[model samples]
Target: MKLAIIGAGMIVKDYLTMVSDIPEIKLNAIVGVEQDVPTMQELSEKYGIKKVFTNYEECLKQADIDTVYVALPNFLHYAYAKKALESGKNVICEKPFTLKLSEMRELKKLALDKNLILVEAITNQYLTNYKELKESLKKIGDIKLIECNYSQYSHRYDAFKEGKILPVFDPKKGGGALMDINIYNIHFIVGILGKPKSVKYMANIERGIDTSGMLILDYGNTKVVCIGSKDTSAKIQTTIQGNAGSVIVNGPTNVLSDFDINLNNGFSKHVDDKINDHRMYEEFKKFNELVADHDMDFVKKELDHSESVMEIVDMALRDADIQLG
Candidate 1:
């Protein structure tokens, strides 16, 4: 698949780092503002990309491109992705697909109507370690509780405190702990347990945004809690408890790494499937496969999962009384 990238931010470097190794997908062009032209040109020369444009629409007009990866800020995801789909190109958008569930539903409808692929570029769902964690859950028997925590002090928080409200802390940019960090926790939980029967959120609010928050999902007999924070750091881990055994996953939930499982009987096992490349590798590989095959069923399944995750995020934000600016 020939692909065009729409952003030249820090995260775009990570995506490009991985895409360089994947031969099936070609980096056709890059689009950014006038000020970013030099950096884009440097990147284009280094990566051997064919074109660079300051206007995204010009990049979209390229007949050689078959897909577009939207890596812009949170608020721009919906607009850029919708335009890409309408322009007859598959879209692979970054996480927190949209600030609201309503926006996601509209994008889903558009993708279906246009017969194009639209996928959220979330890592955990595509990682081999997460798949192993799911398989290990079977040995744990009936699940009683699941706990996932993803928290790290953001570099942007310093600027935020100085009254420089960048996109990460600005409500208008869909900035908050829930959207930036907690969304991954939601993805990890919902991908495993599906949607909960009821949901509630308790957050630490600062300047109209959630700095840290805890979300509770009640699945009748089973209960799950997801903790996400950007103002503080924690020993990030994911634990799944059940009747017969328990599974402990270490390292960031977004990266595939080593984990251990302990059974009630006395047997213990450790599993690791760490890859050398950045976490973005798995996602691009899967996107290439789906787009190449024109697999709408697989795309719909992923979209359904993404939609459920966004629904939970919307509820959590509403309960916290946090509005996207």
Candidate 2:
């Protein structure tokens, strides 16, 4: 797939770092706004990107690229992905797919009508360790409770305290604890357990945004509490509790480093099923397959999961009275 990358953000560099592993993906162009040309050109020269484009629309008009990777800030995802689909190219969008559910729905419709693959680049869903953890759920019996914590005090927090708002802390930019970090825990739950009965969000609001927060997801038989914070840091751990036993995942949910299983029957095991060194590799590999093969069935399934996630996000924001589009 010849690809046009729309941003020179940190995530774009992450993708470039592991580009060699997936021979199916090819870097065709690096695109950004005129003001970002310097960064884009630097990225182009470094990654051997053949074309540099300041105007995304003009670049999309060309026939050289078949796919666009929208790794821009959270607020730009909808507009950028929409334009990419309108250009008749598949899109690999970074997650939190959109700040609102309606936007995600529109993007999903656009991709389907265009008959192009549209997939969110959420790390957990495609991780080898995550898949194994899901498969091991049966051994843990019926899930009764789940607690997922993904909290990292951003270096940006010090600046935030000084009344400086970066995109990661700006509400207008779709930044906050739940949307930024907790969304992975949201994906971890929604991707595995599907939609919950309902959701409630309790946030530590500072300067009109959630600096830290706890999201509760009820699944009728199971209840989940996900804690995400940008103002604090802790030893990240996720536990899936059941009548039979429990599974504990240590470290970041995004990385899924390794996990442990403890059964009531005195059975315990440690699992390390990582497929690659780069946390982003596994998902992009799936993106390559889906886009190259035109796997609409798989794409639709992913969209379904994405929609469910957006629904929860919508409710969570509503509960906190955090109005965002």
Candidate 3:
């Protein structure tokens, strides 16, 4: 996976830190705006990245890379991913794949047509613990209810309150608790249950964006409620209940770092099968291997799951009458 990162933001820095651990993911180049050249250069030098480009087209045309990682602001996901697909490179986009379901479908179609791997860089889907959690569900009988909460009062929330709107809280930048944080819960649910029968969102709106929200997903016999917030904090946890037992996640949905399963028969066990401490490592390692193998079957399955998640997000936003870029 010869990769060219498309942003110089915090995620890029975080990614650079552990990239060397996966020798398959060669950091070929990084592309950013002219204003970010210095930061990009510094990162390239520190991380041993081979090239830095201030122009996207030049990076796409000249960089010795086969994949692009879209780590830009939320609103830029669709356009940048579309461009990478058009440029004949595989893309690993950050979560909330796109603001709209239509955009997701378009990207999926283009990737299929071009025989390129287009995947969302979501963490839980590839985590070992998350996978084990899914398998452990069979021991718990039929699932009845699921509740996931991933709320952390953002440092930017204070500024947002004072009318200093940054991209995170800005409506036009696809910023909100739902898109920014809750999407992980959506992915966690949708990945396990496929799609919901109905979707609804009740949000705490401030200045046109959701500062916090409760999303209800109806799955016939199962009921799921996902809570996400940028204005409050809580112990991040997820619970999946069944008539015979239950599974409890001890950490954020994004990491699924620890969990326990308890049965009605008094049987219980804790599980943590994670390969790496960093949440992104397992996902990227899998991404690199999949891209290396050109495993479109697995990629397509993930794309289907991603599409379901996007559909739920679109429905939730529409139900709340929240418009975002």
Off by over 4 Å in 1: none
Best by lDDT: 3
Residues 85-164, candidate 3, lDDT per residue (tens digit)?
99999999998899889999999999999999999999999899998999999999999999999999999999998889
Indicate the TM-score of model 2.
0.97
How much is the lDDT of residue 233 in candidate 2?
94
TM of each candidate vs. truth:
0.97, 0.97, 0.98
CA-lDDT, candidates in order: 0.89, 0.91, 0.94
Clashes of each: 2, 0, 0
lDDT of 1 by residue, 225-291 (tens): 9898999999998888999999998877788477899999998999987564578888788899998
Q: Which candidate is the best by TM-score?
A: 3
Mind giving the per-residue lDDT tens digits that candidate 2 earns over 10-108? 888888989878888888998878788898888888878889998888899974998999999999999999988998989999989999999999999
Regions more than 4 Å wrong, model 3: none
Colliding pairs, model 2: none
